[model samples]
Target: MMRIFLMATLGTLTAFAPPAHAQQAGETRLVVRPSPAVPATPTPDQQAAVLERFARARDNLVALREGRRSVSDLSPQELQDVLDYDRRVRGDYPDTRGAKQQCIDDEFRRAGGRPSALARQVIALKCRN
Candidate 1:
């Protein structure tokens, strides 16, 4: 009777043991949980920095649009520089993403230039293409 009881207890314990796949060759296990708070908003200084970065990105885009500069003409490093500036601006000033493009389109329209087609192309190129 005692042997049977010991066998049952051992069987239950083995069943509750961690799975083989859960064990790494040389790592300890840890449990992680997501926090329940919203991320903090950027400060005023960060907002200004974001605006400046966006302006720099816009200037690069303008140069690329004009014959004064070419995307292909830029070196790999220069291309990366532009992309990094764009990412920084987007990270901090997400609301301005479409707004800035709209502003540019409005300017062109004010100048009596039909810019929807070009604006679409620019948006495609800058954000996706």
Candidate 2:
């Protein structure tokens, strides 16, 4: 009895739902579908691509710290911006790469050397021999 009452109440609620503009406009109803499942592991090519990108970004960060690169397109903005902000908010700019690395090393230490899955992969591939 309780189940039937709940089903009836649900049916009534659905039946009285505000009409969609699509229905009023006489357009085809949109079909909802789940996306395909992604593979648990990246392909070799995908891994290589990520490593390549990481190398590029790391080089860019180094260059930015050294004033050897343009700041217009800092791919990993946090690499420089966070350190810049921390200093500016409390101190000033013209900080060294050692300062930036210090910030990152501190953060990496805070994570107990356990980076995110992506970071872990990068560290294993790039940071490690």
lDDT to native, each model: 0.73, 0.67
**Compared with the true structure, what per-residue lDDT tens digits does model 1 show for residues 6-104?**
999999998999878877688776979888889789999999987886676678866876777888977786676678776675685445546566766
The ten-residue window of minimal lDDT in model 2 covers: 120-129
Clashes of each: 0, 0
Best by lDDT: 1
Question: Which 10 consecutive residues of model 1 have the lowest summed lDDT?
Answer: 120-129
Predicted structure 1: clash tally: 0
For residues 11-127, what per-residue lDDT tens digits would candidate 2 score against the true structure?
999899876664576577678999999868988999998677666656666777788877666545545554555554567767566654665666577668767987755544544
Predicted structure with the largest TM-score when compared to the true one: 1
| Error at 29, model 2, angstroms | 20
lDDT of 1: 0.73
RMSD of 2: 18.8
